[model samples]
Target: MKKLILVRHAKSSWEHQVTDHERPLNERGFQDANLVSNNLNLDGLKPDLILCSDSVRTITTASIFTSNLNIDESKVIFKPELYDFTGGNLVNAIKNCDDTVGSIMLFGHNHAITSFVNTYGHIYIDNVPTCGVVVIGFLINKWKDLNKGKTIKTVFPRDLRSSIHSR
Candidate 1:
């Protein structure tokens, strides 16, 4: 089985008047990213490969979370196509990943992320909020074999809250 984690870039700051790609993570985004990272750590889910968009906000968010998780930055790849807004583009990027990687993490924007998750995941999510992380488990043994409707696990920040509250 192949495990995939889709992470939306954290909340961004508009105070700099910069282009969307150049916008940095806001304070709330930083905290939320850390919260997501901490929650994932508590769940013992770690990625072997991290694919992130080159956009500043996405890159920063990926960096912070990986740092918090003690993951090496060298395992990350910053790709331009991941910055695209279409779900097909994101799917293609994921399909191109190395087969040896058992677990992969993708950091990008949405509606692509939301569309991809909704199209492929088993669960229905209203929205993929900033700093949201969705864990998808595919039955296929290889990354290249991934297709629509193969999700086994779908989780987000709000789900974690409910799980914690229930405990």
Candidate 2:
């Protein structure tokens, strides 16, 4: 079985005048990233490989997962195509995954990410908010044979934040 996890980059800063690719993560982005990363770690779901967009926000978000999940730097791959706004490019990336890897994670943008999850995942999600995560599992042994799979899990920062009981 092959497992694929999709993560939408955390909220980015519009305060800067830089291009979209250079825009960095805002304070909320950092907190959200940390929250999601911690949640994934607590769930004990580790990725064999993580594919991330080279954009600043996405990279920063993926880095948080790397740190919190203890994923080695070598396992993280920065793909320029993931910067794409459509899911087709993202699907191509998944199709190219090495079969040796059992589980993979992708940190990217939407509506592509949202489309991919809803298009292929057995579940329909209205939206994948910033720093949201969706896990889909395919029964195939090879990445090339990837087809619509089961939506195993979904995690969102607001859900976690709301679940907290303050002192």
**Candidate that scores best on TM-score:** 2
Please report the TM-score between candidate 2 and the true structure: 0.96
lDDT per prediction?
0.84, 0.92
Weakest 10 consecutive residues of candidate 1 by summed lDDT: 148-157
lDDT top scorer: 2
Q: How well is each residue in 14-118 modelled by candidate 1, as lDDT tens digits?
A: 999888889999898887788788767525667889999999999999998889888899999999989888777799988888888988899999999988888
Q: Output the lDDT of residue 11, model 2.
A: 97
- Evaluate candidate 1 by giving its C-alpha RMSD to the native, one decimal: 2.5
TM-score for all models, in order of appearance = 0.88, 0.96
Count of clashes, each model = 0, 0
lDDT of 2 at 119: 86
How many pairs of residues collide in model 1? 0
Candidate 2: lDDT of 142? Answer: 91
